[model samples]
Target chain A: MRARERILGRLRATALPHPPEPPEVASWYAGRQRNETRPQQIERLRSALEAARAEVHDARDAAWPAIVKGLAEAKGVRRLLAGSGSPDAARLAQALPAGIELVCFDRPIDDWRDELFDTIDAGLSRAKGAIAETGSLILWPDAHEPRTVSLVPPIHFVLVDVGTLHPDFHTAMQAGRWAENLPTNALLVSGPSKTADIQQTLAYGAHGPRELIVLLIDEEGAGK
Target chain B: MSQPINFHPVESFKERGRSVVNDPAQRKNFRSAMDFLQGKRRAQFPERQELEGLRDLASAIRRYSLAQLPTLLEQLERNLTANGIQVHWAENAEDANAIALDIARRVQARKIIKGKSMVSEEVDFNHRMQEAGIEALESDMGEYIVQLAGEAPSHIIMPAIHKTKQQIAQLFSEKVPGVPYSEDVDTLIQVGRQVLRRKFAEADIGLSGVNFAVAETGSLCLVENEGNGRMCTTVPKVHIAITGIEKVVAKLEHVPPLYSVLTRSATGQAVTTYFNIITRPRQPGEKDGPEEVHLILLDNGRTQAYADAQLRATLQCIRCGACMNHCPVYARIGGHAYGTTYPGPIGAIISPHLRGLDQTYPLAFASTLCGACTEVCPVRIPITELLVRLRNEAQARPDSEDATLRGSGAGRTKLATAVWRGWSLVYSRLGLYRMTSWSMSRGRALSPIDQGAWTRSRTPLVPAPKRLRDLLRKRRK
Candidate 1:
């Protein structure tokens, strides 16, 4: 407490120079967004995600679950993890074939840390929204869908509703009203985990998912 | 009132600089690495107008944050506390370490996993923890490599940038048990991933650095390409975040602009793999995330920078490391040669306040004043201008009445001071200047050929046959 007082006291004791008002950021990107159509935004996101080595599959709402199952099968995934009590998880379970085993993250991590880290072949979650400009998915981890569901697994499958896509990060934040109430953990994942740390050589799957498979649900056929 | 200086031998910087500059392999490593980075950054900012606009917004946001730093910090404390995240104040390196030590003691933590935190480096946290018989392990792939080799991070962003792949393969095989040597990057990364995964699961405490602490939302934002940061913060029971006090911003809306510029400037990424915004620890019903979260706000000489209005600009740095990558000096000599926790242009300005100017005076003079650092800074820090100011501060009279900087006039010498005074006297008087120039031109033949260090690399500094004024006069006629 004394340290806080001394530090703040020093800062308060000194008068800071008044800076000019910050520029309006909302309009700075306005010109770029003016001519871009919804389909164009989705296309931009697809190319950006593809460039980062993430696989993006455009599917209708009804066919999305089957796509995930097929992708899981193609990857030879045995035990796929899902968020317990989530509607998407329930839908996914109904769509999966009998050959694949479904694992629910029903309890606290302490109950099954080893299983999640070692045994889980893949994890599935729903992205709240996405940023088109950066090809990023926005996730807010909650009690139902814990943070590790998307992080720990070797492969991560995220379902994004194309309608929720924003033109950029600033637009996404404003549209979501994120500042009013934020979750314990909110994430913006641009690609599968990667690193260029070793001699500036690009390598994927550094610590997170090696493959990030995005199931883009285009209900309105915007990209058709 | 006294600022302790970490005095190195006077020629330590030059010696280190010479050694790195002369090594052909190391030079090739740095040259290729820097070229790759420069090209990527250039690609990210293809449109000069848009890049300038973003830079403007980013700089303004940083300035506004610094101006409101004191108030924002108080608000940050209140909100973080209200959010059930413990907040600790650290006035210096010792205070910061002691706080973490206290937390470790309470948690009875044996193993601590760490994300890449430069603040932890600033406080010597891992060393302090080791002294207390607790193991603090670095989980970032690059940091892990450097830690295994028992060395400080060579670069801020890429901690092991100084080392080549072959060297890392050698180090890993020797240090990591049961591992064979391999130069393949993917194979090596997998080895690191496997090793760190177990440590993350077993560690009792996790430590990370905060990129930006949003006061309004009581959140800590961390930007990283690897998932190590998430693992460190999530897998452990307790998560501890450390950051310099200057990292706070007043609102959450300010993050995007800064983050945009930071990623592009630092790594040429549109966005990193993960942008983690942590507001609290694990909630009651949460299945994962840390049970307890603690944030340490360390002042560590930042208050000194904040005390002066102009020096306050130093607080605007977002630690993107663009300045270092674009620096000619850093490219040739590398980060280690600077002999500071932060190296290159940013280090040259900030190290003086942290370690005192008396010992760090050489850093201010190491720059070529090329303005590349100033040009590339995401927040427009005016690095070269600050470098010039610090140089002046280091050479000012030691007892100057209003000396706010520590170790003022450490670089001042009687001979240099007298030389400057005489030069000023002669230049200010027209008759003396004319007489000196006339004699210098006439005595050109008498000029000494062996002119000391300046002549070592180039031709001797003999006076010209005709003065510049005489040449101009002849041109006019």
Candidate 2:
């Protein structure tokens, strides 16, 4: 304990510089001061949303069939739950084979209440964006974007727009404006949910999706 | 269901690797899994510029965070303690193991359900737990597979990267009798889930690894696709998190950048499925989570690495497993060949430092110095440079015969030293170099191979009739 204190003391002495807020922060505040002004953040968010939509459209056209076929192949996947925030989720639902239920939620519900809608074999949703460096899909849940669409299901399929893809973590945080108001829940999914707990055996779909498939839509390249 | 598979350390690693490499069926399964992942990652980024920019930003953040690690760690400890969580500092592997054991004893824990923690692997925590007569059950499915197989993780992110469905089926059949042997992936997963659910419910203590520790909020962040990490922290009566001291960041603001890098670089995902932030255990009136929360801050040679200006960058590693996937040597020989908890490029540099040059000398030479590992590193650590440093350190040991042989000039001490020094002097002066080259042309027919023992192992060089100096002389005339 004494040693821990000593180490802590040493650490405190070497704290990195935390410079004053940049001009952008002040500009953002100034914009907020003018009630009639168009908020730069909101505009950026809108543009990001538009870019995300375009990517999803392209992915739906190119990769929907294969994704549906893969999901259909899973043992228990009968229905897919998708979030309303994802522009592609609705389109993906329309593209699925007849009788395979794909439901989209615009808002959260009690776990028991949501469970009654359908037995979700898989979840299909659009990622807020994608990280290119690690192939991770990011999802932010809110009052409208329920967590169950990403969870609950045995297989989760995320549709990502290439325009929203960032190379590394730093860029992703910057673009997302993470420092301002972080979301309550954010998911960065690389692959299917997996666990290797019982004697070091690899098993997918332990507590979440057994399989995760992402459809990367090149909005500009595909001309969607 | 009975006893976990016994990993005999050295022999088992060779056996496991040989068997996995030989089995075509296993190879197909492993290849397909990796192929799917790589393909997804490739498809995720269409704009190369954007992806590159993100990588740069992520690398910068990690580097910056590690540079101020000591301060961040102290801040994190204070916040965690203020929130009623006990934080223990461990200087090395033994200290970490002892601390974990003491925690178990204090809680009177008979059974432990551990979430997948790489730090626990670094300290060999399960072995220590078993020695103390405590039953430690790995709750993550991938970890469970390696635990059952009695082996170590081949990949940092994917522990059972070397295992096949058939191998898993064989192990399952032996553990759970009367169960039909099936090579199907889903069947195996179902069996594992059913078995582990009971263990999660019954375990008295839960052990986990922290992804990020936020100093301002006193929160430990655990990012996972599976809810097992969540269950491990919440379901058990006591929750213990073991993590490296370098995992600390000064404020919550530092988390997003780190998260962005770790997730993207590890599996090429935008974000992990479940990013749970736990401040304390369950508060008053709370129904879930552990009653007591203990955070083990493991130094384990991290401070020593931090003290060295050249080595401090190694602490920036996020353990994303990108280096391993891209490393040609690691891809070919696999993880067990390295014989350390951490494997591949980062492991080659870190293991020798953590365990010492004597115990981990071979790891330094494990790499081909191909630079692929350095290229893919999320934090941009100069991995190849560090590996070279370790190699130099290994050669400098007091009892090193290899060093003596190289240092003694291979037999002809005086003549070799004088020749080497004279060559250096000649090279330093361009005019002298030209003069020597012109003189050498007079004896161009002499045996080049007979000049030194170093040339004895190679094909004899063709004697030059004229040097560049002689050509220059002819031009001048």
Candidate 3:
């Protein structure tokens, strides 16, 4: 018998009636702070991200680029990688300090594969939003700032507008209606890559970037 | 039925279990690790109401998905194919391994990299690949350690929980050269990182196990702390994901609650480092991900279990390993003792379905039916109830046509069956019950002290001094 036929037939033959739609999840676990102002949400997000081991820096829109440059200088990053022509990149390049080189991931990672993994000291991208509960940065990877920008390099830097911070993961997914028009790939990265595999001893940077630095752009009056 | 493979638990179940219990170091390793994991889980869900609510939602999602499993599987296959990902179905472990090997051959993959996939382990996958001259390297740190040691994973989530840091340090120094042996875990991790980084970049094919396969979007979701899972699915030219047919869910929103309960229950982490949801192979403009992605939907014997209404609850497992972590028997005996890919309470119920009663029925008896497993189960599988049901199955008639209960335990034979038959006959009838009680009370002195295995560690059970019926009458007077 065809494998698919057999497997599915068995399930079909014994299948029960479909139950009701999944109970409306009590996603309001984060609703306690629903009344909190946007600024409070940002603070909650920053604290959560910090706890997850991602360094968070508060900055204004114009100051965000300078903060990135400063982080580059601090990490001894020579060639700082950013998605070319991205909103975050345009601002960073305009404000980039002279000594540090700004390398645009202008083409596909395949075009500059060797440099991306080896030569690039760090990579940066703009996060779609931040989840305060788990302190995770959600990214919807596309052709422009592909997944690799946040993944391959030794160091990762993410930019998040303070207003984009959500109270929790479910609220973000629910509001976004992600199921309807989901991207080809979506990620929820909490911290720098870590592992406790070797006898439960925690270690960072097992494979992905060793460090995750979040540059929180605080737009004063910005609302969700 | 799952025959005893090179590393399968069937032939070596008792021996391996005995060794695991007798080895103080192994026992200590499991006890401490389980304690730490259980503690972490407890701390994460300090509020009972919140945990129970999430569990309810996750359980509903699992059950609802299973109710429409056939439709959902079809939808998943259709969506994946439309999105340019190939889907294959396997009725059993052998078929699954053969299909995976066929994919490897077509791709001419020499060195394959793998994330921690219990499904792959279920099929004795590494051994199969090696026989075909393919090297399957496990990239997950714990799995890599167990692979290097040439042993099966004792625990599902933490494959190398049986090894201590000192043991791992010793193994690394002995196997991977150029590094001086150090007991420091950070240093040991660095050594592993340096060695595995190259393989991740060079592997010809990447294989991973799916945590969830969404039917609505035709996507596979993976949760992991280390980035190896991402690298394997991304770097290789070809990626093959194998998962049980039971993993598919109805919608995307269902993932969050299930994902939340899973990590918190398994490792006591509020959230894992990464939740990667993949819908299609690298699209046309995409630069990094694999060019080809294939998913193997495996049935094994799950369909047989899924056929029964009550037994279907076993499919609700999310592979969180919480049951094992909180299992007292498992912590003491360790994972390798169960002799199945999955161990502890979940294994006991599920193994019988996949491997049949003859090979894995002993696992049903391995548990004390302690409710710790059932208590912490994310989807709240009635593990203890299932264990009791399986015990009855293990005693079913040997020639029974029931595939779900192939019945190969002590009661399957005629003598054992007759012993129960006569015993039941005496216990159920008033005249026989009175005669047996009177005879047993009068002949208490003649009872043998030794009763074989039962008397090995404890005294034989002795009859009561007086009959319960007579005592009740005296009380009435």
In model 1, the Cα lDDT at residue B413 comes to 90
Candidate rank order under TM-score: 1, 3, 2
Choose the strongest candidate by lDDT: 1
Each candidate structure's TM-score, on Cα atoms with residue i matched to residue i, is 0.96, 0.66, 0.95
* Cand. 3 Cα-lDDT: 0.84
Task: Give the CA lDDT, 0 to 100, for residue B13 in model 1.
Answer: 86
Determine the iRMS, in angstroms, of model 2: 7.4
Looking at candidate 1, what TM-score does chain B attain? 0.96
Error of 3 at B55 (Å): 0.9
CA lDDT of every candidate: 0.91, 0.66, 0.84
Best by DockQ: 1
Lowest-sum lDDT 10-residue window in model 1 chain B: B1-10
Evaluation by DockQ, superior candidate among 1 and 3: 1
Model 2 agreement with the true structure over B22-56: per-residue lDDT tens digits: 76765565565455445545555566764665566
Kept native contacts, as fractions per model, are 0.88, 0.27, 0.76
- TM for candidate 2 is 0.66
Cα lDDT tens digits, model 1, B19-130, are 9999999988888888888888999999998798889889888898888889899999999999999999999999999999999999899999999999998888888899
Q: Considering only chain A, what is the TM-score of each predicted structure?
A: 0.96, 0.62, 0.90
Stretches of candidate 1 off by over 4 Å are: B1-11, B442-446, B468-477
State the displacement of the C-alpha of residue B123, model 1, in Å, after optimal TM-score superposition: 1.1
Give the clashing pairs for model 1: none
